[model samples]
Target: MYFVDTLETEGLGNRSYLAGGPGGAVAVDPPRDIDRVIAAAARRGVPIAYVAETHVHNDYVTGGLELARLTGAHYLVPADAAVSYRRVLVHDGDEFDVDPVNGLGLHAVATPGHTPHHTSYVLTERGRPLAAFTGGSLLIGTVGRPDLVEPRLTEELARAQHRSARRLVEQLPDETAVLPTHGFGSFCSVGRVGTDATTTIGAERHRNDALVKDVDRFVADLLAALSDIPAYYAHMGPVNSAGPRPLDLTPPEPADAEELARRLAAGEWVVDLRARTAFAAGHLAGSFNFEGKGRLATYLAWLIPWGKPVTLLAASPEQVAAAQRELARVGIDRPAAAATGRPEDWLRPGDHLRAFPRATFADLAAVWRTGARPVVLDVRRSAERAAGRIEGSLHVPVHQLHGRTAELPEGSEVWVHCATGMRAAIAASLLDAAGHRVVAVDDDFAVAAAAGLPVDTSDEAG
Candidate 1:
């Protein structure tokens, strides 16, 4: 059997596959780039027979139905799936043979837990199962979290998942390769911080933490670390359910202040993707300051409504193009114009907002000595925070800060930091825009901790 997996790094690290044999080729966990999978099959001289999705994904759009339409292949989904789509509902014990050119067979195994309709495929070269394509149900080091769908259904989902994993262990040979749809960097993966895309069934059985014999302990531990879904997840389900939408490549030309004003008057968003200092010095008076410094694509899609025309204020022509591409990756491609003016030109004296003085790490340290201790706000995720965070910091994942503004200190000096300088800048600027004195901290967490700051973690923080 010939197998190929395409890796998409945009939102989550989603893996798509193409498997071929004498029966024909089949695609599994299809990505938005349906053409790539189709072209690969054509090169292998095989007609595609199936386009399959292991489960309904919540992190990014799935491209199974699109591939089916393009290749005239059967679109396959688990028999229990709830989402609306034209698909062949395959049940447990279902099997299919693939003859891309000559000899191969693939068997589908029902693996529910990640979602009610999740399934894994067993690839056979001759008569033996050589590999298993576990969708979100299993990863190299982690098992899929069962809480993404509904909190109330977690127990049922976990029970189902435990059974599914055990079935794979009992039915498939120890040598069978375990090829999962997600790996390191995918939120759907079990502790995917640093792991591989594929692992052997025997290896997973021995090494995967979730595969421990104690089913109750494994399920409880998995449920304990669940995270809130990204804000754009809800929109993606409807859009992807219909079909993959093509992204826009042509961005409108540069706009002057007058043109931008007229566009905004018509209810378009003039997004400023500049440094906090630069934007504070002189941005167009009413532009929404996103700064493109945090989870740019994630927050932009969540906070700004799609299909709303946007004018971008980028640092350079290259940045404008890059920003447009990133926005399109998440389906926010309807940009009307991009600004070409220097950062300061947008302000021109009276148009400028009062630039609040911000303290640097040095300034913050100096203030600590004088009793003016600022509230350190660490705007990073739970995983990043685990590595090391400033000692006296309030955790607020940047994506949720806009809605949870009340939790932050009012009228107090706020210092924000992330794993690096970028997200901190975005958070600091947002705080300033929301009428608070703010500063962007450097990457050294120990520096603040050593200086005797307060730090506490909150479950409310995303």
Candidate 2:
């Protein structure tokens, strides 16, 4: 009997797989933190025989190289990917015995759409296909985005993605498990992805865009729906291709109150990783809040100036460590400093804690009843804004907010909101740190219309 265990990095919206029978296991698209993969193998009571990469990932650093080195496993990477390190260059239709005793093996199928070198791996037991690890090519409901590699090759890649998805459906059994690495919530996905935990080739055949639409339609729709990618993604592909450095999860140096203040004053990122509510209630002045419970890596790495020294202030050491791990996955390997305790603990002597109000759309409506005209800043993506948005609101996606803060109207209290409140809180913190009075709309965007706000449901939203 064989087993497949999933290792999900929810912050980055990707999944890695560990699958094997009695002989050994193979880890597919592992993250930078190899300890979890190691622990999973330990629990399975199997030495990992191989670490496979579907392609050079553009979302997070791959742990494949280190995981393979540590386990003495064959590191499988696409043959065409230009990498500095040594690896088993996997080619189309290449087969490797994962468990010769049980007749378990992996078959590489070149599925070049997510990247020119992207490949999908099929896990077979006794020459019968059991699962297909379709890295960025064949996802649950949508295919991986093709524009990540190079803008000039986007349309060509999109056409390639269609062919690749069809190839998987044609070559694999209908029941072959479609295990993908990018669609869970990763920006690597292009269209509306399914929320189901598991899906098979048969299920995806009826619904997946690549399978449902012809190549021309699929490519057109994919290019149309493509949204802004995380700024940090620009670094991930090169890091993976060149071979990611070993991950370091060591707690950063302790930052005294004065040092924290000095760093903040120097315009360094002093991130407060507390619950959004706690952060809104009180935080050290000039400290930005990226809730420890939220997508810290995705947002922080997307917004912060690349290579800026970061200092973390959290309510506890565990929170700091957790944030550090999340950041490390996206290549923010080392935090300059960290502090734990209440906001007051990180405040310098004679300095007071800063606060911003968190209100719902109802409160926003109530404020408008009194004729208050605060600048409502919609920080959702442009695609989301185009679907529906509060009329007259200024739009700036959260990732672009740091550099575009000047575009927001000055001398007005900015009321910031996103699909949910987490991003709004991040934006609120940014506005607060920039010396603007802000209110975080801690409510779902779904409630905005019912709250009597003027919502414009059209292609154009100001």
Candidate 3:
């Protein structure tokens, strides 16, 4: 009956849980930070029994395998699941009995549809269900979406998801405590679930809009709200399926401003790990402004180049230390140093370094209509463009921009746009340094569409 919930928050929030008996515990859907889970297990004076995943996750990087390797725990997934990892797969009706040792038992209920082989765990204290950990299969207020696949498989998957939700509703008791793997803000849960981390099945059954007993409508509602899933989702799925790589928890130290400047010249990204407000107020020219103060490590791993040397511009010494810890969570080991003083002091006159002009979607559209005729560089990924893109824009993803410099005319003025401002800013700076006049259009397409600019759509989109 011992249960622990770990919440990971940045732009995307993920929750992982450790639940089990006395001698050994089981980790369910552990996040990329395995140290916290390991530390918690050490505090409880128990060895990990197994690291279990409810389904193949498409959001945050899964840390289950790392936990398994670090603690010598078995890695478990649903039986017959087509994943990349070597695991002890459990099937429906499979019982993980810990009763003989610690008075707890776990039963695996095959609940497909979120993926091909999703499972829900029913924990029992004395042959009675106490809690159910429904991974992505069911959230607090919504059921798993059935249409994550291609159009050919969307309906099939949706139907399977519908049946899965109905099966869980039919089998599980109303009063059973329910803990889902994701919450609000998760790309996986999207708009279906609310923000709360945990709730009872009884509460969900009564309050959940998607679980209203009209299965077809439930499936339709879930599918209709599906937007373009983040590339990180599919990117992390294979990582989870195979097993999480161990992250180095010790982040490197910061170099002085001069040294950081040298590193930046050497093609390193000096990420300012401050807040956007801090970045907007004043920051080192050319510093990428993700400033993920809290989940600094997560975004560092996600957006910035992995294992690349980083120069951190933290607000304080404590913030620097916190940044180091966060980076270590995801194995980003090389952080060069904090700037000598405030980030502003480093911005001296005559430094060709310039922050790109940031514009909202509406503003950019207006600029596009002007006679200036700036070259619009769509810095979003090709997959994102498949959904919809601004017309007459050249495709140059941020990752490939540095490599494809030859494609750009050296003196041409470039206007960059991504789904958001973050990538666009980064791309604009790269273009600027490479001798192109660049500006950043920092708005979502909705804003662009509202401005009545032309939008091109394609079938390959999300």
Q: What is the C-alpha lDDT of each candidate?
A: 0.70, 0.92, 0.68
Candidate 1 residues 160-273, lDDT tens each? Answer: 877888889889888988878866456566543235545888887887766664788877777766765666767775666566665446666878766876886787777788
TM-score of 1: 0.81
Candidate 1 positional error at 119, Å: 1.1
What TM-score do all the candidates reach, one by one?
Answer: 0.81, 0.99, 0.72
Pick by lDDT: 2 or 3, better one: 2
Best model per TM-score: 2
TM-score, predicted candidate 2 vs. hidden true structure: 0.99
Query: Candidate 1 regions off by >4 Å?
Result: 21-24, 35-47, 190-194, 242-254, 262-269, 272-295, 303-310, 315-333, 339-363, 381-395, 404-412, 444-462
Best by lDDT: 2
Tens-digit lDDT track for model 2 on 1-462? Answer: 889999999988899999997789999999999999999999989889999999998899889999999899999999999999999999999999888888899999999999999999999998899999999999989999999999999999999999999999999889999999988889999987988899999999999999999889899999999999899999988888788889889889999998997898898999999999999999998989998889999999999999999999998899899999999999999999999987788877798998989999999988887887779999999988888998788888999888888887778889999998999999999999888899999999999989989899976664
Give per-residue lDDT, candidate 1, residue 50.
81
Please write out the lDDT profile of model 3 over residues 400-421, one tens digit for every residue: 6766867976777777788867
Model 3, stretches more than 4 Å misplaced? 1-11, 83-85, 99-102, 146-151, 256-259, 262-268, 294-311, 316-341, 344-462
